[model samples]
Target: MNSSLLLSLAITGGLVLAAIVAYNTWTLRRNEPKKAQPPDPSAPSAPSAFGAAGMDPLLDPILRQEPSLDGDLAGSAGASPLEGLDRGQDPHDHAIDPSDALRMPAPAHMAERRPGLDPLIDVIATLTMEGVVSGDAALAAFPPTRRAGSKPFAIEGLNDATLTWETPAPGQRYRSFQAGVQLANRMGALNEIEFSEFVMKTQAFADAINAAPDFPDMLQEVARARELDQFAGDHDAQLLFVLRARQAAWSPGYLLQNAARVGFVAGSMPGRLVLPASTPGMPPVLTLGYDTQAALADDPEQSAIRDISLSLDVPQVHRSEQAFARLRDVGAALAQAMDGVLCDQNGQPLPAMAMDPIAADLELLYDQLDARDLSAGSVLARRLFS
Candidate 1:
């Protein structure tokens, strides 16, 4: 039992214990799954940021696109640039992509164009003059001067400074005579009957003024114009949903910060947020704005958000139903999350029942538009609707 012998024994026992612990640890680690390493910062990320077909806004391309007008404007006929829907194609064959619908179209100049005058103009002129007047007789008429609240129509060479279509002085003699139908008025397109009356009046004036006596069938022209006007009426709607916090006033900073998480970006207008379209230059399908004066307060750091609103521009968007549904869901979610009231533009609360009629109307309009080869939110539709 010497002290040196005892010390050696203790050291050996300690070494044996350490070896056992190390071996157990190695075995446990080998059997267990390895912990995942942190992702490589420089490596490309999975495509989770965007949805299938690049629908998500987060993955929107940096090279933003405006609605393409090339094919429509250039008259590249045959297959339609709009996939799934053509003049003769089944309208319900495809779903309008949400992302695509949200994108704003180029300004009218950027898209397909029709001549200012209707095709029937030349025909009317030729028949009236019996080939004496050039087929380009519409050119003789001053282009309809569009005055706010005034129904302007092309007057073929009627140069009387005092004459408005509303009151063409009867028996007034002029070097040139009024001809053709009044195409459109300030309110909407003229129906067939209106055009017929216009034709009669113009013809009478032609006779009184010793102008050409021939008349052209304006029924077809009137029908086409009526359809165009009807389309415009159906699509010119603007629907709005409002949210007002039930608790404390909203923090603008927090609201703006979280809004981006849900896909809204700073809008062009101050105190507004916009859901931009997939096409870069097209107008946004959805816009949200604040009602509180704080929104426009000079202070850039103002955090008060007393009221918020969500709006859908019907004509500008492709699928009204989808847009409406998405808008409703998003508005409801935000309202619930923030303890707010969900209401319509009139401040009346909206229940599930309220949306049903709206949805039905949307479907009906969509069907009508489709039947006419004017799909909602398409370039041609947009132009005609506008």
Candidate 2:
């Protein structure tokens, strides 16, 4: 009996100890943070990648609230004369302040140059002007083409990959959509020519701030961008031109007569476009530069997902080389400053400025531009240059 009692006691003790350990483990687990659950696939809605809708950067003075289209985008609603006119000033509503034009938008005005006109002119002029100065008559050989705006310029098979949305892990999948833009690194080298030109114009041995040592050299670039826009028939001309201007742009302050302007892009010129305030890590033109398209494939749930097909023309800078990686993303310094946001979403990304907009209203505006016929000298052109 004594032996049996001792055995039973031992067995009971062992069971009790195991029960304590098991209970403690259960308690600890119950108090621990629950594993992060995946987002329910059937949720009614999710916040936008930008976290909101109906956002606007600059409101029209009159309309007060509408999609803020870049003024120069042909059919932008509530847009001003310069809607799409950042790099180039609309000579129409914007009378080139005779003083501004005469003085030149060199380094002195650099500090004051906000988003419009100066950088655009500076970069494009930089890119094309040198050829003109060196007497590359081929650029001037452009036959007079009628008024054309916002046409698709063939990229000669840039072959940006098509993108599709991933149903699983949509957040990570969406992040990968940047591949198309990343692939556009091929254009970076093309911009080096522009920067070289910027350095020449700003640093050239011109005696005066505004003087273009090569007279028509600067103007030739504008003509080319315009011609490219007219003939090529896509936003690529404008976009590439902007990229070149922003990235390649440099001011020598080379040998200005004004001591203050000596190291400046000439006292007459403005310094540079300040990057807009960081809104969720986007620069202003990032939104402008990116075009959002629908995911190539539809979700069975029709999860209302879209892919943003963004092609960035980057020059080498920082580790940004890892992203686009063609050459140093040329104007990465400038791009570093731009902040972008998705202020709103259409059911589809078609007609998204830069992408396509699916919204009926936005689409109509896009259609108007698509159907728009610029008869060589359109109203906007005639009013300005004429």
Candidate 3:
């Protein structure tokens, strides 16, 4: 062996080793999951997941904090443009203020009544008092439990001064009272046994208030409950879309980071996030949930999550928000960002085509709800569905 041959072979071996290391590094980098960028305050807001068409401004990540409706209305409605004008000045000289234009009050039929038990969803028993009674007395006479079986039991007093029916409050006086039990809910329809219990509870309260109780026919009320329950069962729609990891499993932090990019905030429960509704105080438009155990683990960053679910409770959301469309977009956005596939509960891949039928059916359900006067997102609908 010559010295030249030995030197050439050693150099070649080194070059081959260097090539292998470079290739390995490239492969690892390419295969690694993508990282989400920290949100930038100065950057222009990203468009909707699919496109700008029909995008809700409420869902924009940059503008997630919506202005309060009351604040907007108060600033505009509280002031009259004609203010500060000199009393002696001619009113005709100034430009007509748009805000000063004549405003019409909502028609009686157009205005929704304050939240309370309704005959359409409750079995009411009227309690006619001989004279006005103290609210404190009525409160003391109330039933111990607020529920009869699965249905809610509530009592409202007719306020002597306000001329409105409301729950009895201290320091108020009532002319009459009414007790009601919800007719149906997710649990089931109110049965004969529950109706009897409601009557007994009402009668007891009436005796204490020195009122005459008038109960409805038991069979008729029970029958009404069944019909309502059947309608609810037929119309209720809870849609779920599962996102399954394609290659790399996600850590809770990684999953959360991507979810936050799409406007989901941490929910009250572990492993849950919610896309809030545009209307404050209403239920979330959508919910994103993953493995609770992973979220609870000591090192959530180390826990692997293979799948997460996005759900929408149809009747709970207003039709105007276009929640289903938002759900579809969010699901797609998450799936793409996480390198996952959207699937059904059974793990079947959910194609775009599969969603169209669901949307069509949803329209029909909304029409049915509107026709029945249990319009989706109304207080009554939320109560009945719950």
Query: Which order, best to worst by TM-score?
Result: 3, 1, 2
Question: Per-candidate TM vs. native?
Answer: 0.47, 0.19, 0.76
lDDT of 1 by residue, 1-386 (tens): 69999999999999999999999998865433222234456865433212322232322434232233211111111221121122112222321212223223322222222433234222233213322322233333333332212223434443244332221334442334444443332245655555555555555545543466555566666666666554344344445667866755665655664445456666544566666565655556667776446556565234456568776655456763377777777777677766678775456677877777666565555655555555656654554433
Quantify all predictions' global Cα lDDT against the true fold. Answer: 0.49, 0.23, 0.72
Clashes of each: 7, 56, 0
* Tens digits of per-residue lDDT for model 3, 309-350: 877767777777798899888988888888899887667888
Off by over 4 Å in 1: 1-187, 190-227, 300-303
Candidate 3 regions with alpha-carbon error over 4 angstroms: 1-113
Query: Candidate 2 lDDT, tens digit per residue, 1-386?
Result: 99999999999999999999999998866443222233355755332222332212121123121222211221111121112222233212221111111111112111112321122222222111211121122213222321112110110111113233221121121111100000011111113344334334333322222223222343454454444333212211111113211112111110011111111111111211111212222211221221112112232122121111112211101111122221113223222322112221221211224322111222232223223221211222211211
Clashing pairs in 1: 65-280, 73-112, 102-277, 103-277, 104-282, 104-283, 105-282
Q: On TM-score, who's better, 1 or 2?
A: 1
- lDDT of predicted model 1: 0.49
Candidate 2 residue-wise lDDT at 22: 100
Better of 1 and 2 by lDDT: 1
Name the best candidate (by lDDT).
3
